[model samples]
Target: MNQDEDAAPVEMLASLCEARGWQYEFVGDDELTTEIQGSWATYQLRAVWRSEDHVLQLICLPDIRVPDDKKAQMYEVLALVNEQLWLGHFDVWSNGMVLLYRHAMMLGDDGLLSVAQAQSAIETAVEECDRFYPAFQFILWGDKSPADALASALVDAAGEA
Candidate 1:
């Protein structure tokens, strides 16, 4: 699609969320916030459209806090988790308590953000957050090392029937 024919990412995302019956709100012309409910936690995701740069940034904040004392160790766990992740990386706010997972996609020259693409991005963020949340819990509450925490979290025991 040509640039003029491209649909705005914000509009596409909003429509996708509405069709899915997900709650979302527009923080600005180019920014939106939505929530995803997971088995472990509810994640708040914010999407920002950068028209000038042709990029969409998705940030996910799970409903958990890293204690101040645990922030250093959390960073270590995040580094290990990020290494294994293909899309997003874990990061802590400067306050050292708020944890976030972030991912970004290039909009390409056409700037056409498809419904499938938006759904995929949202699913990825929610899945990643749910997958790594237990590791962070292990680090903060179980006194597990970064490596051990990640290992435990990543172990998949479910088998095919």
Candidate 2:
């Protein structure tokens, strides 16, 4: 099968689960279920609606399970990079939830942090990625590193605060 075909399962599953109030959980490629969490902070994805009072395990990509809710403004950010970054498929476990790191960073593109919390959140996310997403690296602001143009944008955003 081609890349598209391999990637289809995760995308379709995510879309279906999202439509039915089901959340995605990232587990390794196996039968047993495991809980995945961020390496940096106490961040975990949460299901808006519990599936039978139990979290569902989904086997797909690491970044596939980012929370769909919270920070209404972040949707624009996520949508902007969907093509470049989120094109791959991931496995999600059903019993896992995402934790929103209160003190995470937000690396922006303007070489200035557009938001103060961006840095902490970014750090948290990076750590989370490191822990659960070793194969997949975390890129902020289009750059391939922890500190880059996106970090600056995050600073700029925080300056407004």
Candidate 3:
């Protein structure tokens, strides 16, 4: 492996974060954490590079809460939401109050996570969270059904006036 590929993935992630001027810190030996500010919300981004498993996991927390009464419908809404996602899926914590987006990929023989891959993972996560944040809000506050919430979220306005 070349020097870049040979470098520990976590170090590379730290480099990437630094180059991008993202505020992040080493949460653990293998984890880097940051926050992504998107149009809809600020998301917590965590990158965990598992050397033993050759896996890189990216998690984005949208920082929304699902109350007990809303959890069931929120899950249903998430089902519909997940179906439309091209990468990663939204999940709730065991406490049923926190919603996070997670996507993981295996490193190839070189065990490298390229900057492009990292960027795409982050962009996808933030975009999806921004796109679907309202749907989650709809279910949480609008009293909309899963289908209705999804529909409300996905509908587009056509006007240039």
Q: Among these predicted structures, which one has the highest TM-score?
A: 1
User: How do the residues 9-48 of candidate 2 rate in per-residue lDDT, one tens digit apiece?
Assistant: 2233343335445445534321122123444332243212
Superposed by TM-score, candidate 2 places the C-alpha of residue 80 at a distance from the truth, in angstroms, of: 2.7
Query: Ranking under lDDT, best-scoring first?
Result: 1, 3, 2
Better of 1 and 2 by TM-score: 1
- Give the runs in model 3 whose Cα sits over 4 Å from its true position: 1-7, 156-161
Full-model lDDT for every candidate: 0.84, 0.31, 0.83
> Number of the top candidate by lDDT?
1
lDDT of 1 by residue, 1-161 (tens): 33233368888888877877899999989999998787698889899999889999999999678887888789899888889889878898777478999998998887768777887999999888888888988998999999988888877312212
Residue lDDT tens for model 3, 1-161: 33244356677767767777888989889898998788778899898987888998988998998889998999999999999988889999887579999999888867777766766778898888888888999999899999998888877311211
lDDT score at residue 74, model 3, on the 0-100 scale: 93
Q: Cα RMSDs of all predictions?
A: 3.3, 17.3, 3.1
Higher-TM-score candidate among 2 and 3?
A: 3
Question: Model 1: residues >4 Å from true position, as ranges?
Answer: 1-6, 156-161
- Global fold similarity of model 1 (TM-score): 0.90
Error of 1 at 147 (Å): 1.2
What does the lDDT come to for candidate 3? Answer: 0.83
